[model samples]
Target: MSKDSETPEERRERLRQEEWKDNLGGNLNDSLNRGNNGSLVDLVGGLGWKGTGILIIVIVLGFIVYSVFFR
Candidate 1:
């Protein structure tokens, strides 16, 4: 239970939980924690070159479909 005995990850988790608890509302907690896992740039970077290319292709195709039909 002592902070001195806890590992780094444990300390980080404890801090995050404390932050969540001290918030005024659930929305503030949600928004604050939303980017804990990183953002879109992180996602693309994590996907590597091939995966990023595939994702781009999929997005372009989706856009084409939406443009042709919705417009």
Candidate 2:
């Protein structure tokens, strides 16, 4: 039968199947691109201790400024 002639249930099932296939394709693509050794620790490790020290300084300065002005 033609698509236009299909019942509502058949149409809904077809759409659901298509969505499932699309999701599977996306997951496969992401996994293949990620490879091994790609993780949160690797990302944070790139920043290292220098970045962490800079971030801490900024936070402390921000707190001091807020207390002096707003409080």
Candidate 3:
């Protein structure tokens, strides 16, 4: 049915579906490209496999440093 002939509920549903289709993968791509520095989720999402590996190595080294010096 044309948009003008649709009931309010049907129009809302149709628009919602259209919005979802338009934004498909857009949010994921945006989040991956523009990660928030303060958010761990964003950080991990933004970092691909290699970056995540390096991050894990850095965390391990940092923990070792703290253990050796702070304790």
Candidate 3 Cα misplacement greater than 4 A, ranges: 1-39
Reference-based TM-score, model 1: 0.46
lDDT of 2 by residue, 1-71 (tens): 88999976577668867876779977576567657547544454556668867877998999999999998
Worst 10 residues of 3 by lDDT: 33-42
Residue 31 of model 2 has an lDDT of 62
lDDT of 1 at 27: 44
TM-score of each: 0.46, 0.38, 0.42
Model 3 RMSD, rounded to 1 decimal: 13.1
Candidate scoring better on TM-score of 1 and 3: 1
2 against 3, candidate with superior lDDT:
3
| Candidate order (TM-score) | 1, 3, 2
Give the local distance difference test score of model 2: 0.72
Q: Quantify all predictions' global Cα lDDT against the true fold.
A: 0.77, 0.72, 0.74
Which one wins on lDDT?
Answer: 1
lDDT of 1 at 3: 87
Clashes of 2: 0
Per-residue error (Å), model 3, residue 14: 19
